[model samples]
Target: MTQTAQLSPSSVFVVSGGAKGITAECTIRLAQQQPCKFILLGRSELLETEPDYAQNSDESALKKCIMENLLSQGEKPTPMNVQKIYNKITSSREIKKTLAAIEKTGAKAEYISVDVTDTPALQEKLATAVQHLGPITGIIHGAGNLADKLIEKKTEQDFEKVYTAKVQGLENLLNCVNPNQLQHLVLFSSVTGFYGNPGQSDYAIANEILNKSAHIFKQSYPSCHVVAINWGAWDSGMVTAELKKVFQERKIEIIPVAVGAQMLVKEMDNTNHATAQVVIGSPLVPQATELDSELRTYRVRRQMTLEANPFLHDHTIAGSPVLPATCAMTWMINTCEQLYPGYKLFHHQNFKILKGITFNESLAKEHILEIEEISKVSFENVEVKATILSKNPEGKIHYHFSAQLNLQQKIPIARPYESINLEEDNIITTTGKAFYQNGGATLFHGPAFQEVTKVLNISPEKITTECLWQEISDKQQGQFPVQWINPYTIDLSMHALWIWTQHFHQEACLPGRVEKYEQFVATPHNKPFYVSCEVKAKTATSVIADFIIHDRQGQIYSRMLGAHAIIWSMKLLRS
Candidate 1:
């Protein structure tokens, strides 16, 4: 193996086997453009060969032919010699001079002779080279070997030989390097590491090990950047002429090495994360074939679900377990709160203990009653109504009622008669009318026409009377012979009582159609009362109507009180 270095006076670009094929040539060109020195690490023998023909034309064709010949002879090739031959075949002298030209451009150049299999010696040589060139900032471990023997034909030594040189060499490099000085460590892996082929078990295992080693190194030194470039099949000496023939016959396309190297450089420049696995040829192909297959299956399942008819999907109602009616009530309460704040009936006296009432029985059998207590002094009355309507969605019942009051005095008082003096009146007689009043009536008794009577002084009789007046006809005052008073006095009392009764009635009404002022009708006298009755067809259902009353202004009087009456008549109607 021959090594070459492209160098600027300050920095060295090191290429192992720089005089070899496209890999070596590309490395020299990259060194030329960058401001760096170069140190090529390779065997001394390859450096002595001419550029035109450093080795025999069949030299690239040697590994497989030798392996086959040895296998046919029933002799297994020694692992160490196989590795030595692999390294030697990859080294070239002309590649080294090309790297030297890059160094001539204001850069330095050097070559270090070292065997990778000797870990300590290799580390010593690398450290010496870094000391001479300057502290090493990056290292690309591109050295590798491949074999095309099937697992059955492959000996354990074959596997160990390839893996140790490639995987172990990279691992040793990571171990020997000072992590604080190195910014990037690039490992060249093969697609075979991720996807296995029929006859490349040894090659696949080596590459897989290399990939894992990169990850291990990265984890061990988190600050030190690591990258594994899983390159596709490249046209190189490693892929010999005979192997190329086999690959072409198998319709496998070889990837250009330049493209792979460029991608590696780009990824190394990226500072997003320290570790990355970059595949060169196909973007979609996963690094692992088994994982790729599983992903594809999952995608297919998801697509089938997406393609199915939406209508066929099941949509069971979701939420807390609750009866339909109770759920409806909860929803209604929430909706009411949202629409009209402070209008919700949850805390009303009638709305308390909501869940216990039966809608049907309550509305049908219960008669609404309103009691009023009237005070003559304040002329105010307190009215209370009791009735049951259909349970509101909010679990409240309604009632309807009216009240009347009469305010009258119903007692009579007797009046005293005039008194007379008789002692001094015997000589003088006086004539006077004697009058007496009793129980609101005037009368004269014990008096004759032109009577000589001793009446000294007489005062007008005074009488007081009261009556407990019941409602009577307006025209019947004369027949009863009682003092008639303003008829409106009684009417006003009744009207006031009616007003008081309505206040309680509305309070007791449930929130529904009738209570909501829909069925209520306004009368000519401006009284509000519900005229329409709602009948529900089912026991579980309810009907709502509005209660309308008339206002004093003669316009139709209605207020949305939310009165709902449940039809309890369902059973009776069914019967």
Candidate 2:
């Protein structure tokens, strides 16, 4: 049987901050894509009260210069689309002109000038908009103030000014939206909220509150989707020439107009969650180094190292001493790295640690010990054999030996000299020859055969067949608290590495060490020692020794061994 599908109602969009460049363009584009009724709300009037006021002397001059620049570039200067939209929003003597302009674009547009923070006025405006248009399916609450000032220097009035516009205004708008009709709510926050910037405390706090409010709303109303968009500075009215002058003097750069708007719109369209943060700038995509420059706390580093004895407890251990510390470090680093990567040497700290032992030496020895025990061991009914061999040019040579007395099983045992003689065989023997525990067996060669070759010479004939060997236990664990003399070290390194990898390797980049090594300087009678490591490289080959490790596989194996040792040690202590 065939079924007819019913189409859901098209989305109706209401956008605040229609006067802002990015927000305005985003709102219009959203209406165009969804074929929805639109309501553009802002404090400023769309149409100028007077024709003379509409075309300011500076604006006219700017327009003339823009046209002249275009002609000189051999490009035809069509009337700017932005100017048309601006004229429609600001030129209309009344609401009719604005609606007509919007109708021409195949969408209905309405304007409301009431302050969003005025609850009653906002409610009335919302009702009027819905009656004239339709139900509101989406809203872009972009209205907010950008009042920048250092936290210590900022006044209570400055704090109120920003919060009144961002938090209060947003709360009023949220109150106006009918849950049954509203599906998505996009809150315009700023990067300042995610990562605080100096000389922007007021702005940052306001945006942060907005972000938090979105989360609260989402938690309270699961059906409604709330998104918090953390935008980088964009070329808009908020960043006017006067404001730009202030920022430039303070060394802060505003983002390009087009780029900022594109990022904001992209996030608005794709995001649907409570408290989702999306950044609007280039630095944020690859990594937010530019923003990090201003937010010092957002620049941190993390590192970890793991040691083990296979015989201690069934020879099984697994852990990184730096694990907990590294974990906390990673969190701090990621948070700061996402926010700021440029600021150097700003000290702030937080730390944590966790450790545990799962087994002991007594437990390990219970199941594993001596060649006789290994030979007599059987999983099911299969008999096992234990033998030792010496390395030769031809291959390994098997050694024959024995244990005393009783033979309860049909297993075979081959042990060499009752006491290993270093002079003759150059081999060492331990009291415990072989032992099995935790699904594996461990064979110990005492202090006399500590070297690799000594043990290799007396290796089992059929190593795998003789016993199943697992990871070792009883290991050493430790962590380091690293502080950078210059915090920009990691940030610059990451950026340089990223560029090199993208331009040259075109392959995944590995984490490279950032070390300061100690060296000795010697004079005739006096000697001094210092530490240093080359931080930069002119060629990839030059970086091999200092930045890259050739034996990563071996390093990883060693780390695993260390982890096993730590785990086993902890276990032993616990037992």
Candidate 3:
């Protein structure tokens, strides 16, 4: 289990727009969880006492009393006047209640009445607070305003008010404190920013800025637990009864106050600093045209460079860095996952390498992954046609790899497979150490790809070997970055086929095609697993085989069925 970075009791938190509503609720909950000092920043000034006319908690009774008092003072009781008076009294009451609640939880609560957008005023107030309470340990940037209008109908002032409150207010807070010293930084974003909503263009833009800023700050200060939660509609705060009805009708999930608060605490307690953006609650419905479009082809472009991926330095072939077939599958699967959220690549079929990406020659610097079509095969399954392509200066596209990917919402059970027996009948000809070191001279791979430790048996029918993967330490993590699949382990499985061809045909080879690939679980490191390479057919130019990685009990971890490798000239290995 991952250890959580719990908050300290001495921690001081500065919350913007925290005196009332959702921010107040979250702040109070945090205080309840860990008794800490909270400096609430907002525009409302806390009233010491309620007026005689507004003493009643009942809204109708209080409004009636206020109207009677206005009449007695020879003042008009118009709807606008009544509402203005009602808002002031009720807002003050809420702020007072929040402060009292925090104090009841054995936490210090101080309300600062200042507009967060006023940079100079905010700085002065925060400076004085820090002098009294010491440096701030965390910040919850929840200051935001909503100006709901279409782009053409929205005014410039509307955009300025909504955008400045979130973007500029966060800037003011960061300027007042040192972000590097902060232990936790939470920015309340919205689903509208992630999935654009109508009549909220300004709001969407402001919230998206918050999300982007969270990433920037987290990267700059790796120790700080920064997260921009793209929250859905909540049951309280700005979500009115009418808004709740609308959301329910649209099938949008409403996050309850208690649930949302608990989730916030959990997020703060999490120690995974790599996660900077988190989306909670149900996703908004996309337009029918987006999902049902017949002509839409999703495209993802990424730069291919050896310098960027340092792992390639250890996957050199013929003394040159070459992209491994496993890494190629990873790129394609990653793109598919990105194009379609909430779905994972369960299986890959017809994965073929039309042309390998060789860095030793004129290779494309940028590659494009295109999902040409998505065919729904069943309610829970979909087949995706994805291809990787590149373009030269002449604008001619070259297809490098293509595959049919099967995506599913749930993981399927692993199918049973046959295992190898290294009994006395099966003669052991060479050890894996000898094969890679000197016995297998045609095989050229760096240390990272050399995972086969011992060869138990080798023949025309099959070859069994012992494999081990060394756990990379933090210092060497940069060279072999973590991925969905271990590049080295899969490379080792492919190496089995190469060894078979080298043993029989005396030819060097590279993985050309894979009939099918299924990954059930991650290959554990620093543990010995057996690889059984069963050759079905072989020729002078190519060798076809099935590879399996399993434990001593024959429980399969992963399988590559019908793996095809193309034979290369002996001169290439000598080079």
RMSD of each: 40.3, 23.0, 7.2
- For candidate 1, give the lDDT of residue 312: 12
- Displacement of the residue 286 alpha carbon in candidate 3, Å: 10
TM-score of each: 0.40, 0.47, 0.65
User: Against the hidden true structure, what lDDT does model 3 obtain?
Assistant: 0.79
Candidate 2 lDDT tens digits, 1-575: 11111112356677887534567666555544445577888766554354332343355664565566567778776787435434553434434444554566577677887777788988998898788677777778888765676578878888888889888887787678776566777888888787666677778788888888777776666565667877776777667799677566445668886565566556555543323555554222121122211211111222222223222222123411111212232233334322323322121221112222124321111111112122211211111121211223455432221111111212222232122212322232211222212221121122211111111112111000111112111132122212222111111112222222222333223222212211011101011111111133333322321211111111100000000001112232123
Candidate that would win on TM-score: 3
Better of 1 and 2 by lDDT: 2
User: Candidate 1 residues 1-575, lDDT tens each?
Assistant: 11112223454334444435554555554554564666665544444544332234455466655555567779887766655655554454354655566566555666666545678877888788888678765666666655568678887787777777676776666666666666666667778776656667777778887788777866765555667778777776577899778676545678777665565556655534534566665321111111111111000000111112121111111211111121122222332222222122211122222332222223223222222222222212111222222333465555332212222122122122122121232321222222111310111111111111222221122101111123333243211111122221211112111111222221111222222211122122212211111111212333232222222232322222333434232122112
- Candidate 2's TM-score reads 0.47
